[model samples]
Target: MQIYNFSKDNGKKIGIFNSNFIMSRIIETNKGAHIGCMYLEENGIIGYHQATIPQLLLILDGEGYVCDEKKEYFKVRSGDSIFWEKNEWHETKTETGLTAIVIESEELNPSLYMPKKHWDVSSVSF
Candidate 1:
């Protein structure tokens, strides 16, 4: 697993006409992609399981913890994104609730577009 920042701090300002706003590019895929929003209520947990395909989780609000095959939890917050390779074991849980957008596809390549954040986790390998 890897973490990336997609906050406004990393976005580009768009000034079209007289409007001004920041836009953060998420992903662009020519092939079909699976996208969905996840709403985990307080004290919720998404049980550990192997990813069926390359997956990216973009935290939209609140905070939560994600664990890999090693079961070591990593704290994540809004604007933070997590990536997992296909068949990688992972799980997500929260004590104070969290919301995120999940993107899955075989062509997902975040490293090519987003800047990766160094995680304190000992190693991504399990």
Candidate 2:
């Protein structure tokens, strides 16, 4: 049982992310549960990616869009939370910028996947 504060931790640009963004990790554990705050600058793209465990991104501020492997795209804003099932491929798009809290399991056995060669962005909207 521990209390983690987002504002207390200093953020750093993670190299693993293809996008130009920074994240501040609130909890770094050896077992389950990891939390962090991520910020993406304008026109930044997280790129289609996958996670090992289930992930939930709680939008804290700004706005953005999320798309799944099926090209299912949707808008997200502050206070909204999006969930990605284990190993689910997804991507984020931001025209202005975005800030959100990312939560996932620390014992992640991630298996990344390649994105589809072709897709229509206007295929889905919400």
Candidate 3:
């Protein structure tokens, strides 16, 4: 598992038509890619399972915790992007709920687009 960031801090300023907004590019897909939105209600959980394909979860709103194969949970929030390799075990849970975009494909390579978060995995908990 790898965590990347797409927060406003990493966005590019959009000056088109004098607009003062920033846009963060999320991902570009190849053929046969599947993309969808995932809505987890309060106290929700996406039970741990092996990824069917390379997956990228882009948190669009709220916050949550993600667990890897080691059973260690890490805090995640809006603008955070989590990637898992095919057959990798992972789970997601939130006490308050969250909305995210999930992209699955066999050709996913997020590192080429977003910068990886320098997180301290040693600080992870259950």
Candidate 4:
């Protein structure tokens, strides 16, 4: 077991165009389980991306928009959480910045649970 301090961990650049978003990887898989917290600046956006491992997102602060390609956008704020399966394409747009904790693990791991077809990506396969 390990403890992570988001404020002290330091944030790193994650996006292509804008470098305002910062991500601090709190925990990572040594035995195939991954957990982390990401902090974003106001008006920052994390471009669309997909994960090979399944993930669950727990919103910790601020407000934002979460969306996939096919479905309508959803608003996310503090105390909200969502799950995304492997290969699902998603992105976040924050108007007031946001902080979220992410938990993910290998697909074969029974301890990890993921949503089914959370997004409508065509080519990607998990």
- How well does candidate 1 match the true structure, expressed as C-alpha RMSD? 2.8
Say which prediction, candidate 1 or candidate 3, comes out ahead on lDDT.
3
Task: State which candidate, 2 or 3, has the greater TM-score.
Answer: 3
* Residue 111 miss distance in model 4 (angstroms): 12
Candidate 1 ranges beyond 4 A from true positions: 119-126
User: What's every prediction's RMSD, in angstroms?
Assistant: 2.8, 13.5, 1.7, 13.5
Tell me each candidate's TM-score: 0.90, 0.59, 0.90, 0.58
Instruction: Itemize residue pairs with steric clashes in candidate 1.
Output: none
Superposed by TM-score, candidate 3 places the C-alpha of residue 92 at a distance from the truth, in angstroms, of 0.3
Model 3 CA deviation exceeding 4 Å by range: 16-20, 120-122
Number of the predicted model whose lDDT against the real structure is largest? 3
Deviation (Å) of 120 in candidate 4: 23
Worst 10 residues of 3 by lDDT: 117-126
lDDT of candidate 4 over 51-121, digit per residue (tens): 56776666788878777655446766665555567888787778789998777876432223212222233
Candidate 1 per-residue C-alpha lDDT over 1-126 given as tens digits, one digit per residue, 9 for 90 to 100: 988989998888999898799988878887789999999999988899999999999999999888888888888899899999999999998999999999999989887667887676554222
- Candidate 2, residue 43: Cα displacement in angstroms equals 0.7
Q: Is 1 or 2 the stronger prediction by lDDT?
A: 1
lDDT of each: 0.88, 0.63, 0.91, 0.60
What C-alpha lDDT, on a 0 to 100 scale, does residue 41 get in candidate 3?
Answer: 100
